[model samples]
Target: MTATTSDSTNAYSTPADDGASTASTASPAPVSPWPRRLACTLVVLVWPLIWVGGLVTTYDAGMSVPDWPGTYGYNLFLYPLSTWLLGPFDLFIEHGHRLLGAIVGFVAIGFLIAAWRGDQRRWVTVLAAGVLLAVIGQGVLGGMRVTMSARVLAMVHGCTGPLFFALCVVAACVTGRRWQRDRVLAAANHTQQGQITANPSTGLPADALRSPWMLWPTLLFGVAYLQILLGAQLRHALPTSSPSMFAHTAMTHVATGIFLWLLTWVAWSVMRGCGDLTLSRPAAALVCLVAVQLLLGMGTWIVNYGYPSILESLPGSASYRLASKNLLDAWIVTGHVATGSLILAVSTLLAVRLRRRRWVLTQLPH
Candidate 1:
């Protein structure tokens, strides 16, 4: 009897010890900050790259170098700085854009290395690899645009820049310490919803598992990308495009802009109501940015083609003349282009973060 009681106690104690060991072993390792920092740096570099690329387009300086992978028959990096600096405006912008692109590529490589080395998450590593691949592809596209002198290629290149930037932002988000902590907490919180009668976080109905609000960020992202495509089409319209076709495209673009503005406002309101700062902050920015973009769209038109005859009755409108290729015209046009990229980046971040949050929520009792 004594031996049997001792054996039973040992059996119970052994399983408890093993369970504790398992829990400790399963705990996630600490995330490294370096990967996140490097990714953020890559994201920053891409914005100026987009801006300079826009300037190249705004000034018609795409073919200034007339060579791919080289400048004036000299190696790209070996080209004389003095000539590049003191050269004509087109050469300066074109060469500078190329150099900036190369820098972004190098930073992407560093990010990939850091992620693979420090980030234990397979997805994070894959995200870093995707960023590098995108940077390479973007470089190739830009090169092809120059070698083939295809305007279509130019448009594609322009479109991909923001997409690549968006990926970098994602990489940064996933590699963040807060993201890792949230993932671990969500995993720990994992329990069958059937086991719990109600959510402790909120007293909302269990049916709120698939909330309609969860889809808004994703919808906003889609609309924003569509707007980008339409804008690119208008910006790179072929010489053969008829005035009627251009007018049609412009009207479509304007209609889409108004719809996007409304959608952004709705998204902001929903996110704010949810009280999720991560989603709401970007949503708010998207609202402000879309508003600014609409204004910039107007400024871009006024700078490029001047105000309408109807607006001529206004004091400034009557005096506003379309300055062909002036400083102000270039800045306004480039600002519009750059702002579009910014809006897309912000929307991408919000969409991804919200998606992750929703996934976590789905795993919980709610």
Candidate 2:
């Protein structure tokens, strides 16, 4: 008999909205684990070793020891301290490399411990442990080179340093704070876009299959890695009696570097067109680095050709001239190595960010 009006507000409310709100509020805050920070610190700390190793390699100091596992039959740490203080320049360079290598070994141990005990991501911790073991193997390879005094072994030992640096870069990426923050933010964004849906076939979300911004970074990373490999080969190549080897390798290196810059530029353009400011910033940074590299390359050439006077000085009296030469060489080598490391860092960040973004977009409830 009496008309009853249904509650309009309750009738119109959806369960999805309530669920999203509750999930958002109930999600745990991200923990700042010690392993993550330790991993990052290890990466930062390893750069010095990379630089020192480069110096040793460029100066042909790999044979400074002429012995493996120990220096002149004494433990690496206990080897005559006075030799380093009074020995030839090669001894200084070689022993310095050993010291840096030992330091890296210790840091690696700490990194492994932190990864095992402090990291939340089990796979990442496992990977870090693997990297630590790889570094130890690398040390053994260095010792073998000393014992054998084989040029080929020396080349392999030299090549492994960059590979080890790259491993550390990976470790840094896995435990990075920026990566974790991006993952959280991306997940949140996906939820807001309603793009999150689990696929019935693969059990992965449809959004995971999308994201046009990632191809650019991946392409650039490939180019950079290939360029480094080529450069390493060139470094180990025998010196030719004819200048053609220098000309050819130098030209090829320069050309490849130019191609790398162009590829990076294209990647940046793609990022910009896609409205991906996150990637665009690193792209711009890479562009600047390449530009610096070009200048340094040209500077080395000019100093090499235009300054014959410096080369004429006597060995002992030419300290100033030698200093200038060393300075230029150091710049060129350091710039090359640093740029390579930066490329690795930026590419890794982009890869991780894009992955997180994909994950977030896929989780949205469209």
Candidate 3:
């Protein structure tokens, strides 16, 4: 009987030992990277819509239909197939923007679902939901702008695009393993016995957070966003011919562009000095985008000037105007807008990376 009791105890203990061994050997389930990649991909995909929307705005096509949620008495989708198929191009651009808006709405919904299901991080899921809500609200605001024909609403609607872009940026950061790794590294570094002191001149924390690497990029992003807002207001003022419109706004846009150019230079300097490849790569990208934006701005001005309205020409006059009024100009305008959105995205990413480094510096066990 004692032998039997010993055997049973040994059997129970063996299972217990096996359970412990299995627990140790079984690694935590690998976190899928798909959600993060999807979030980033979605952000990029939405840029075309941003560009298209900007074109629609610049052309003052907001009220082409003079109706909300419909394009001339039919639901947006059910609008007469004949009209949709053979509509004025203006109708097409305006309706196309609406359709892209709907697509973004659905994409945002999918992102929310993926984040909620696949991400271990709760904030990521919450942020995805928030973005979905923002897209929905923005859609409504768009409809309202069409209904009211209010310039103020239009401005608000335009401004919301960048904010939405920023939110997606945050979502991307939260979902990425690199961001988490940086956070962990920073924490570990900061908690070390000897905390690094910030450089007195630059006010950067000695550890990872205050790296001049982070500060300059964050500043560049802020300036870019302000520039975009200024540009939007200038475009908005064009149709109204408001005396309150300052030619200086255009000049301000130019100045901001210059500032952005210089900021890129500064970022490059910082990157070179710091020798951080991560920071340098993104800074280089920012510089390239800025260069492209400058060219686009100049091209837009040239196009506006060189192509006087052919319709304004006397009959039989040579119509030297290229296809300047069609989808191509719209696309150029959209690209300009999208570049601004990209700037905002990259800037926010740098800021988060810096923040994680800082968090580690501050919280890691010293």
Candidate 4:
């Protein structure tokens, strides 16, 4: 009887056995460097592509090369460096934008391969595939726009850029080390929704953050995206656009900009008061960037349209074009464009973090 009892207890698992079982089952996952690195590479490459596209628009150089999938009848990749480098400035920017876009596509392929090999999540693989498809579609649409002389297609292609940028950024956030670490922390704590209702430290009410993360950030992202599209319409429209249409878009851009600013500020306020640096810091950066973007909007107006027409009411003053958009104009406009993408990306990152964190909090093993 004594021997049977000892055998039964031993069969159940000694402390050491329990420790071994826990170690085997709960060992922290090895962080995959390639996936995160590839995602980051895509993010870096895509943003510059945005700037290059802006430059193409800035110089009215979209048709400088006058060829589709090629530069001046030469295969795009085979185009001579000497010709491109010494070419007229407009051709340089336009062709360079094409070349940069190709590079982004290639990097996207790399990211897809890396994610397939390293990210075990099936959804991640699907997302990478979607990104690849978007890149290919972007390339085709750009080529078609140039070949068909379709300005409307160009507007569509322009709008997709920011969305692609946001997608890449969100993927990077999900593949990041910190994101994985948070998952582990949540799993280790096995946090249940109703249990302990407060955050780890300070006993602060974490419920205060629920809506901020769950709903507000996402709403702000959509608003920013709409503003981007409106900005793109105004950009692609330019002097050739109907004056009334231009004025309406311009007014809409400013009005939406103010609305987006308020949304971001409110999000930041909620996050800052929530006492989570992970959420609060990004919220803070977002507000600052949005502020800078508003300022840049002003600069964009001054550079392109000159001082407001209202200023013409002054004594002996009249409305006039400002210096015909010099190189400074190009840089300021491109900076504004690039910053808008960055803001969009950052907003995406915030939304991903908040949504994931909320999921972690609510779905903790009960």
Top candidate by TM-score: 1
Candidate 3 error regions (>4 Å): 1-26, 30-34, 80-82, 182-214, 238-244, 305-330, 361-366
lDDT of 2 at 342: 61
lDDT of the candidates, in the order given: 0.77, 0.61, 0.68, 0.75
Cα RMSD for candidates in order: 8.0, 10.7, 10.5, 7.8
What TM-score does candidate 2 get on C-alpha atoms? 0.74
- Tens-digit per-residue lDDT, 204-254, candidate 1: 333333576568777877888888888898899999999999989888889
Clashes of each: 0, 7, 8, 0
Question: Candidate 4 lDDT, tens digit per residue, 1-366?
Answer: 111112112222222232232222233334357877888899988998999898887777887877888888898899999989998999888888888888888878887888787765556777888888888988898898889988888889888989999989877876775564234234323333334345565555664544444477888889889888999988888457888988998999999999989988888877765556778788899889999999999889878877786766765446455675677888899889889888889888888877765654443334
Q: After superposition, how far is residue 159 of candidate 1 from its true place, in Å?
A: 1.1
Count clashing residue pairs in model 4: 0
10 residues in a row with least lDDT, candidate 4 = 1-10
**Cα lDDT for residue 176, model 3?**
63
For candidate 4, give the lDDT of residue 353: 79
Q: Evaluate candidate 2 by giving its C-alpha RMSD to the native, one decimal.
A: 10.7
**Residue-by-residue lDDT tens digits, candidate 2, 3-40:** 11111111111122222332222333234466666667
Question: Which is superior by TM-score, 1 or 2?
Answer: 1
Q: Stretches of candidate 4 above 4 Å error?
A: 1-31, 181-203, 211-214, 238-242, 312-320
Score every model by TM-score: 0.86, 0.74, 0.76, 0.84
What's the TM for model 1? 0.86
lDDT of 1 at 344: 87
